[model samples]
Target: SNYSEEPSRHPSLKINAKEPFNAEPPRQALVSSYVTPTEFFYKRNHGPIPVVDDIERYHVSVNGLIEKPKELFMKDILNLPKYNVTATLQCAGNRRTAMSKTRTVRGVGWDISALGNAIWGGAKLADVLELVGIPKLTSTTPAGGKHVEFVSIDRCKEENGGPYKASIPLSQATDPEADVLLAYEMNGETLNRDHGYPLRVVVPGVIGARSVKWLDSINIDSQECQGFFMQKDYKMFPPSVNWDNINWSTRRPQMDFPVQSAICSLEDVNVGRKGKIAIKGYAVSGGGRGIERVDISIDGGKTWMEASRYQKPGLEYIADEERSDKWAWVLFEAEADVHSNAEIVAKAVDTAANVQPENVEDIWNLRGILNTSWHRVHVQVRH
Candidate 1:
């Protein structure tokens, strides 16, 4: 496997893996701003980072179960009505390290920052599907066309050296409200090569795996994508089912992540001078659900304080608002008085009332995906 062509990344990024190139921003860098800097955004790749230089030759093929299959070029996509969407893309395996502590699980070890929010600029998938003769809100399945698979240009060993791919329901793809984008821009700038250059899919409110980078081809199918990541990996299995009893067929592909929150201000164990300390971090939920509340417990889980949540600068954040940040994370902040050692904890509740589990053991899975357990950090308050 050749790795000489990997793009240069920010020096501050904490490297988790070197081969497939998975790294995330430091905990302090995550809540620095409402929108994550492009350089600081986490890089999660399955294979070698692909580079797209041929602008004219680069095109996305829309085929499979469509009436009019078409190969759309850059100009063709640009001609469609463009929209900018602000959404957060989080890896399903985010915080896998914490889950592994309970029992070993298989997958890359990711910290608390394996996610980022960005303003994606591109043509809507609903509009692009309309170009292929599929109307918006295409829910009814006539010819068993229910799923939309997105194939990528990046090659990974998981599929025996095949391109990375995943899929979503056709109804979700055709829903303009879903905010599925064939993104060519990130944070008002042309997407860097590290992120999918030229084109990529930005499926808001879903796991980052569904948003295939390095755009290649779009396939409409009767069934969900059968790719390695979709079929074999990213499934949630109970603790009773180990590798021996685990049957991939028993579970479906994991999609939207659960409500999650973490305190970025303190380390795993912080020795802070006895005083009122400021605690800040990010809280988010999946499937278009907004964070309803972020509860902070500085002295273990005995007493809790509701952290003030905000998305925009100097403004209160209200979940369920008809705003673009609905799919984005809310930065929570609070001040707590700690006279001695304390166990800082952060628990988030989505607008749908989905709360993070108090313990990782309850939701522990073999794949180590979606570790939405309450984030706890031990802080040693010194006098």
Candidate 2:
């Protein structure tokens, strides 16, 4: 393992695993800023981080099922049109710990912080694809390409030590409106090694797994990449489908996440001075959907109250507003009287009117991925 080369991490992160360095920020710290700091952003790696020291020698090969195959150098890519897109990338396995408690499921034991919103600066993938002779919004290449696969330089155990890889539909890749980027900068600065230093793929509105870090190449394939993460791991399965009777091919890989929100102001259980308790958290919907509203339930899911949400502080957040960032998460805040012990909950509705299911059991899967159930916490009011 290349663990020796791993970069130092923040002291505040709660380490869920040591080998691949899977960790998330303290819940309170996560909601402290509109744009999560680079140091505080959650780190999710399947294997040892790859160290790329030579920026001049780095190049991403773009080929397979295209009219012109080209190995684009780093300098060539930098000269293209640059766009800074604010997007949220959430892990499909986020909140797996909550799902695992229901019934032991597989994969990383993440809390709520397996996601982050950042200003990703890079060349639009649609523009890069054009340089390779494929026009924008062309679903299928004339030579029969259907998917755009991103190959990473990082090797993971899931692939039997092969490099990490995944793909998106070629149509999504070609649609400049999709905002897919070959990102080299994050949060207004050059990306650190843990966040994919030299180059990476930032597929806005998709699960984090599809945003391959340390990108090595791009392939326009006739079908999606047959990588382990794409074919075996990230797909959601019915609760009844245990490892014994599981069929990996039955369901497709998870892309856009459903409407999800979490209250981060208090811990799972908190004892506070009796009075009004302020609640704060974040709400995000995938596929470029905006959060229409966030509902807070002080008496568990018995009843609800609307919470105020915003992306930039002090500015009104209207989901349908033309100037609002469609891909970023909106922070939600609310206040409620807490005279006694209470069960507090929060759930979000996307612009599309998609509401989160109230119970984890209703959406429980064998893989324990996409646990977007209502977030509930207990508050003990000190009398």
Candidate 3:
């Protein structure tokens, strides 16, 4: 709607979401750490960023299938035991541009700029649900129970021509390890309006779109949320299905993000004539499986070297509360001696041993959703 607002600027990058003020630093700028500074983090908003000027009056409703429906204000939520998590939020369509290069796809034309890592602070969704009580399925309940839907205060017209809201499965919502949150702060500061001021749902390991912005309502149901965004949009399709032959119903909406990694620097860009060229970037796997190792290859898919990894300290909810492994992106680096032109590639393997798909085409979908192809860049060595 209102795209005229001048977004806050980052010293590093080009701003993409002006009203919500979304921006991404250049690839080289991402090589340093796992926790991306708030200013340099990428933002993805689906509607005019809702501004919450009054925190005291802010209320979040937890309704639907519970015996006691509760409406909690800001103070009530803050009164609970506070917890923090270092996690990464990625748009389901982060690398859509790369997919577009192969075939024209619909939706936001995002570059690699739709992803970012940050330390999210809030009261855990699990804790909140425990206080209010999440309804349990009974003998009379249907065989296939689906999800607990989340709705945002912000609304927009959908591609299928109606209002949009986002949701996630009940299992993900109730899992203590999911570390879903009613996040009120980002990177240790009060949430900015563009980033969901009073409250927002932080669904770790799930796509960013499902992490609804603006505090609103939570409903538990046996069927998926009927919102246009969940039912019609954000669905994935087989590569064979072209725009002309698209069957919307045949495609399933994207849920968990796939294992993915990218090389943040290239050898020829700024490497010395005779020194180690450091390759760095972040690796993450959706569904809470921590990334185990990142493999780098100078000659595209040939020999590989394991990159050194940096793990941030904190409680990683996605990896289970008892587990010490970090849920945020793992900063990885490797040094290699190069003397000629080479096609450098990087791929990550998660604890589950789920590796990134070899090529974009192999996992290419009609909508360009979940484009986690191996990250590749070409470089030339100086003599």
Off by over 4 Å in 2: 313-324
State in Å the error of residue 125, model 1. Answer: 0.3
Q: Please give the range of 10 consecutive residues that has the lowest summed lDDT in model 1.
A: 313-322
Model 3: how far residue 45 lies from native, Å: 1.2
lDDT of 1 by residue, 18-83 (tens): 999999999989889888999999999999988777899999999987778899999999999878
lDDT tens digits, residues 1-383, model 3? 55555345566776554544455677766665556777767767666666556767778887766666789888878987676777788888887878888878776666665777877778877677666665322211232445667777765646332334677776666666678888988877887766777788888888888888786777756677887777666887788887788777775678788898887775324434754567788888887788999999988789998999887643234344533235567889888876776777889999999999889888787778888999887676567
Q: Which is the winner by TM-score between candidate 1 and candidate 3?
A: 1
At residue 277, candidate 1 shows an lDDT of: 85
TM-score (C-alpha, index-matched) for candidate 3: 0.88
Q: Ranking by lDDT, best first?
A: 2, 1, 3
Clashing pairs in 3: none
Q: Candidate 3: what lDDT? A: 0.73
Residue-wise C-alpha lDDT for candidate 2, range 145-176, written one tens digit per residue:
99999999989889999999999999999999
Which is superior by lDDT, 2 or 3? 2
